[model samples]
Target: MISALTAPAPRAGNRAPRPIYVTKGGDMLNPFTPTPTDPPSYLAKYTARDTAPGLARRDAVRTLLSWGLEQLADAAELVVSELVTNVLSHTSTRTINVTLIRTGETTARIVVMDTDRTEIVLPACPGDDEEAGRGLRLVASMAVQWGVERVVTGKLIWCDLQEDR
Candidate 1:
């Protein structure tokens, strides 16, 4: 089932409100279109390459810091890196779209979309000492909530993190 929380009431002179769907676990299911007056957000597309993850991490950090969300920088950086890396490693997609949205007063959502239709395998515990694996596992642990959804073009994987206050 899908549930949604309406975007917070718009600021004066802002456009009509939009709804953001969320899973029961609090992971965002839909990427809301931002009105001009909405809170800070970052969206960009990157070529699917070995360096994309690092580049995405840099963008994620810069965006968060710009919004005074530096407290989330560490987690956000790791999450963005892992998600982007997963795409380049697992899928044949040539590009990816990364979006960082301010979902609430202290909550932010990171979404990575790739143009591949492969089913996402839920992360399994990697045996210790393995030199690989564990990217998604790290994301699952850090994110307050997260999940993947199939989209017409490919798949959207999102995770939510809230500043500890």
Candidate 2:
């Protein structure tokens, strides 16, 4: 497991410092902020094929189960499936990397990274009659926090899930 390097002082916004995870070599795992890197709690790379989403979902569920977070399995599975499916549908990238991190005793994070740099756009308000375009909204409803961040190679979309939900 990677150790956290707490920031010595509060950030400019006065928010309490967040735990920063880094490599022993002093390289930041994520450029924008600290996140799990190098050896994530769970990591899997999948080709952008039809079976990719299912496989990713399976891996996420398995990882959560192993961590004794069975309550999050259903939400995590759907979140993983939708994120991976979005990557496959919108990008031509050959592979997608899925990472799951146990943030707390009953909270975990799910991240999907792909080569596509296009920013994700969500509908202002998807109509009930629409057959699609509700995946991200569903994710937003289920997750305590969700967002996308740009990396040097690609963009990673992430969401935080809590067992209470």
Candidate 3:
């Protein structure tokens, strides 16, 4: 698994940090308040064909931060890129959907849906001479928790992130 590097909290003298909410598709049902029944704070939807240029993933993460999820922006973006790349490389589907949700004041979730239902396995980290095989490892390291769920038409791979409240 790829290890996550945590930067120390900002020094006390710095101004208070701004709220960060990074989402990909869907709308932010609650921008300021966190409620029990409310949906995720940010959402993103895409199709298999949407994975062509990697910038889409970056834009999606930026949108979430703009909507108020700055803390999760970087990790979410990395996860999105790795997951989406896997979908494009392994599945025959032409579209996929990605969503980012703030489940609690200190937790966020990243979900990727694809028409393919095959299980994903992370390949062993290769030597410096190898060109690939490290995506899922990165996901395992960065996410606090993660797994896959089978759906009627496809599957969803999701991960959880614990944030600093």
Candidate 4:
């Protein structure tokens, strides 16, 4: 299932509020019209078992990000950290899938899928003195928009960050 939520405030009077699209399973929407030359530049898949190896998952993320636009590298790393950490902490599933797809020279989508369907709630950022919290906040701040989508056995959470045109 894919669900959408909009930001609380509107940026313009005439424009309709844009929904922050979220999905769990298969492709939620075809955001792009058919384009022949704009095939994905690189594609990489990682399973849950890959996360067991220390630093392997992080390295995979870094490697994938390296192939795409450079500007989104930091946000990609942060999102990977939070999503992977959530899987490690909240579920017994050891494997999570990460796929990087380059839709255009300046656009890419980072998807993290795990065998848990629980909705991710971005909690309020904690005070500087606090020790925990703030992962999703960082994700929300960095990604253009993100949300969870439920699948048959698990769920997929994805975020998109636009690179320079």
Q: How many residue pairs clash (N, CA or C atoms closer than 3 angstroms) in each of the candidate models, in the order given?
A: 0, 0, 22, 5
Candidate 2 lDDT trough over 10 residues, lowest sum: 25-34
Could you give candidate 1's per-residue lDDT for residues 1-165 as a string of tens digits? 555678889999997687664434212222223323476676767778887887788878887877778889999999999899989888999888999998887789999999998887777667888877888878888999999999999999999998993
Candidate 1 segments whose C-alpha is farther than 4 A from its true place: 1-37
The lDDT of model 3 is 0.66
Best-first order by TM-score: 1, 2, 3, 4
Could you tell me the lDDT of residue 32 within candidate 3? Answer: 27
| Candidate 3 lDDT tens digits, 59-146 | 5566556557677777777888888887887788656766667776656787878887666554676988988888887888988989
lDDT of 4 at 122: 47
Each candidate: RMSD: 10.4, 9.3, 13.5, 13.7
Better of 2 and 3 by lDDT: 2
Worst 10 residues of 4 by lDDT: 28-37
lDDT of 2 by residue, 1-165 (tens): 356788889758896777865443222222222244433377767767998888788778878887789999999999999999999887878789888988888999999999876766554676889788888899999999999888988888999999987
Q: State in Å the error of residue 88, model 1.
A: 0.5
